[model samples]
Target chain A: IAGITQAPTSQILAAGRRMTLRCTQDMRHNAMYWYRQDLGLGLRLIHYSNTAGTTGKGEVPDGYSVSRANTDDFPLTLASAVPSQTSVYFCASSDTHSTGELFFGEGSRLTVL
Target chain B: AQSVTQLDSQVPVFEEAPVELRCNYSSSVSVYLFWYVQYPNQGLQLLLKYLSGSTLVKGINGFEAEFNKSQTSFHLRKPSVHIRDTAEYFCAVKRAGYALNFGKGTSLLVTP
Candidate 1:
């Protein structure tokens, strides 16, 4: 289908290690976002890109970084993984025409030890 | 800034019975409201949205919601729910930005 695709559907990493989650979209949407879903915190925005070559932080941006090298890819990296950072990460994309609608990926489940 | 609140963390209902999922939001400026459904082991999908126009908005799969400006609420309703409708529902709010603020989510359990 022509929607968001997230990589590393599930992973386990030791503390102090580095990890990266890959996200790609074929819809050519103008905006993409990274969000972390927790037990009772809902989904908090980690980072976002309005267009290629530009990026911005979201509600919870600490310990995480993102880059929008092109319109189709937005990768999120964790320099030093921590147990607290372990959660389900989702990548989403949207366009001006869709208004507030967001197309989400299946999600990446990461566990830190 | 925008924030969403889903009153109930979980709701239990019987099949073929009506169900209501409550959602409330807080925002300073004009806002857009949306409801999303996530089935088991799946990504979230847009159920419906309320941008502008009438207060009532109908969505896919016999789902609908009313945007109440006075109460700052956008609660979802279904005339009759089925076992297939068991899923997690989320309420989200968006301002003039590309990101959306979401609620904790409400899990609907439709039993036989």
Candidate 2:
């Protein structure tokens, strides 16, 4: 099963450009999240959606925005990509049962120059 | 809110040797703890989790962890390891209804 699928397995973007990391899950989960992985800094939450039509800011939401228009998609957009934003982005989803078992995508490696 | 600390950033051990990766968390309210393993170029996969009931949780890949409430620790352990076990291990925690807070991650290197 395609639990979670992300677009542009890797991308190279120029600074100040607009880019969106698309994430879709077929598990019909109620929660979705976006996280960035950087060296030494680990994984930091960017944005999240509790369910359809809802979104919330996470720990590191600056320069990023997300929308959950429906149950299957939660795409993260970088209004103005910066070099500092270059990192491996991961999309994850989980059920509302509270075990917090996240099903993650392979990841999108974004390089902002 | 909850925070996780994985004491070891890297661990090196010989094949078939037992290993333990330390993890500790702090939170005012109750927390759910998890351990995830990421193989090269792969997404993080569940190693095990401690929600409630049993303090000792056994997970896939013959890995298990014991949750210590007094010390606020949930350390992952394996009695004997294989080369396939070498990967990046992450310790994460979350208060109910919150995003998971991950540690810096520990890279496990298994040698022959």
Candidate 3:
């Protein structure tokens, strides 16, 4: 499909392990975002890229890093995973950084033990 | 910074009954409003949005929301809901060129 795709639908890793959640969009959008969905917390932005080669922090960017070397891919990495980082991660893209609707991927569920 | 608040963390109602999910936001500038629904273990899908037009915005699956600028509220409503409507509903706001700020979310439980 010509939408966002995320890999490793679900994963279990040990604490301090390095992990990466892959996200790619075929829509050729300029804006990409990473959010974590928790039980009570609806969804919080972790990192975002306005365009290729530009990255910015979000409300909860701690413990997470992202790189946007190209327009199609925006991968989020957990340098050293912690149990507190366990949550469902979602990747979304928009046509522009302004008033465009978002298209989201299914999700990547990560569990750190 | 813009923020959203879904007053009711949980709403329980009977099938076929009317329901409302309240949402409020805090922003100093003009913003766009949106409502999204998420099924179990799935990502969020846009339910509806209010950009510039009538305050009453109708969405998919018989859901609608009203944008009350004075009140800073955009509450989701359904005249009659179905079991399929039982899911997590999120209210979000966005300023220009920025990612959305989502509310905690309201879990709607439709019981028969």
Candidate 4:
């Protein structure tokens, strides 16, 4: 089953450019999240959505924004990419709001130069 | 707020040797603990979790962990290791309605 799908599996972007990371889940989970993983730093939540049409900012939301228009898709956007934004981004979803097991996507490796 | 700490950044062990990866967390309220494994070029997968009931929780791939409330620790253990077990392990903690807080992660390398 395609539990979670994220695309442009890898990308290289110039600083100040805008980029969007696509994420979709077939499980129809109520909650979805965007997290960035860096070397020596574990995954940090960028944004999350508890359900359709509702979004929340996470720990590191400075350069990122997310939207949840439907239950299946929650995309992250970087308005102005910076060199420090280079990292692997993962999309995860859970069956419940916060206490369910999370299923993660393969990840999108973004390089901001 | 909840935070997780993985003591080891990297661990190297010979094949067939027992291994342990230590994890600890800090939280004022009750917390849920989890262990996740990430292979090269892949997303993280759940290894095990400790929500309640049993202090010792068994997970897939012969992995197990014990929750020590007194010490605020949940250390993963495996009796013997294989090369396939080499990967990055993460420890995470979460409150009832909060986002999961993850540790930096520990890379396990099993050599022949």
Candidate 5:
């Protein structure tokens, strides 16, 4: 079912460059999220959407922006990439209910030089 | 705001030995707890969760965790570990109407 899929499995971007991390899910989930995983630090939330057209800031939303244009797509954009933004990004989706389990994408490893 | 704390950053154990990963959380209101596993170069996957049921929650891969309200803890335990169990484990808490809060992950290394 391709639960959740992220684009550009891995990438190398120069500092100050703009990049977008695409996330898509076929499950038609109402909620989607973006998170970054770094060494020692666990997964930190970057942005989230409760449903189509509604997005919210998360724990670590700096340097990142997200839009939920539809139920299937939620993309994260970095206006200006920085070395601090270099980390594995994951996309996740969950059903309308918060109690439901979350489905995660493989991940997008971004290296900013 | 809710927060999670994973007591151990790394745990080394041998195959067939029991292992435990401790987790503590602080929140102003009641919350749901979960444990997720991430293999090398992979995304996080749900290992188990503690909702409103019994204290002990059993999940896939023979892993289990117990939720303690007074202690504010949800410790993951596996009676016998396998080489495949080597991975990073995360403890998470979901506050009402909020995103999940994850603690620093615990890297479990199961040696043969």
Candidate 6:
């Protein structure tokens, strides 16, 4: 089974443009998350969903929004891309929300110019 | 609130040598700890985790971590390193059903 998959493997967007990064998981997990990885900063949480139809704000959720309409898919959208948003984005899911062990998808690298 | 700290930003070691990556965390309540590794241009993968069990937790790829409640630390260690072990390692903690709080990753470079 494909554990997790992210679409638009790489993208280049001009500043102020809108973009959406798609993520899907086959594990039927209840928890899904969005994170951005930058040099020397590690991965910072952008937003998360405890379960389908329920999303929460994370540490760094300024320019991004997420929706979890179904169990298998969660998408992150950037209303207006900025150079600061240029980073590798990752999607992750876990069988249970309480446990910290996560299954991650190959990242989507976005470059905003 | 929960936070994680990875003491080292970069570690350089020769193959066959033992290596340790230090990690410490702070939380108001009891929490679970985990270590994740990311290879070049790859997603993060679980290396190991500490739940309610023995202090020592062994994981895939000959890596292990010890959870010290008193010290508030979960340091990852491998007895012998290989060239394949070169990657960025992250320390993460979760408190009461919250998403993981990750520390600044430590890049490990295993040289031949």
Please tell me which predicted candidate would have the highest DockQ against the true structure: 2
Q: What TM value does model 2 have?
A: 0.98
DockQ order of candidates, top first? 2, 6, 1, 3, 4, 5
Tens-digit lDDT string for candidate 4 (A52-103)? 9999999999989899989999999999999999999999999775467789
For residue B59, what is the lDDT in candidate 6? Answer: 92
Residue B20 error, candidate 1, Å: 0.5
Q: What is the DockQ of candidate 4?
A: 0.79
Residue-level lDDT for B62 in candidate 1: 100
Residues A1-113, candidate 6: write the lDDT tens digits. Answer: 89999989999999999999999999899999999999989999999999999999998999999999999999999999999999999999987744757999999999999
Computed on alpha carbons, the lDDT of every model, listed in order, comes to 0.94, 0.94, 0.94, 0.94, 0.94, 0.94
TM per prediction: 0.97, 0.98, 0.97, 0.98, 0.98, 0.98
- On residues A28-58, what C-alpha lDDT tens digit does candidate 3 reach at each position? 9999999999888889999999999999999
Candidate 6 lDDT over residue span B52-91, tens digit each? 8799999989999999999999999999999999999999
For model 1, state the Cα shift of residue A109 in Å.
0.5
lDDT of 1 at B85: 100
Where in model 5 is the C-alpha error above 4 Å?
none
**Clash total of candidate 1:** 0
Q: Tell how far residue A25 is off in model 4, in angstroms.
A: 0.3
Candidate 6 has a TM-score of 0.98
Q: What is the iRMSD of the candidate numbered 3?
A: 1.0
DockQ-based CAPRI category assigned to the predicted complex of candidate 4: medium
Task: Encode model 4's per-residue lDDT on B23-105: one tens digit a residue.
Answer: 99999999889999999999999999998999999999999999999999999999999999999999999787777789999
Candidate 2 lDDT, A68-112, residue by residue in tens: 999999999999999999999999999967587898999999999
Worst 10 residues of 3 chain A by lDDT: A94-103
Error of 6 at B91 (Å): 0.8
Q: List chain B TM-scores, each candidate.
A: 0.98, 0.98, 0.98, 0.99, 0.99, 0.98
| lDDT per residue as tens, model 3, B6-103 | 99999999999999999999898999999999998888899999998899999999999999999999999999999999999999998887888899
- For candidate 1, give the lDDT of residue B36: 97
Better of 2 and 4 by DockQ: 2
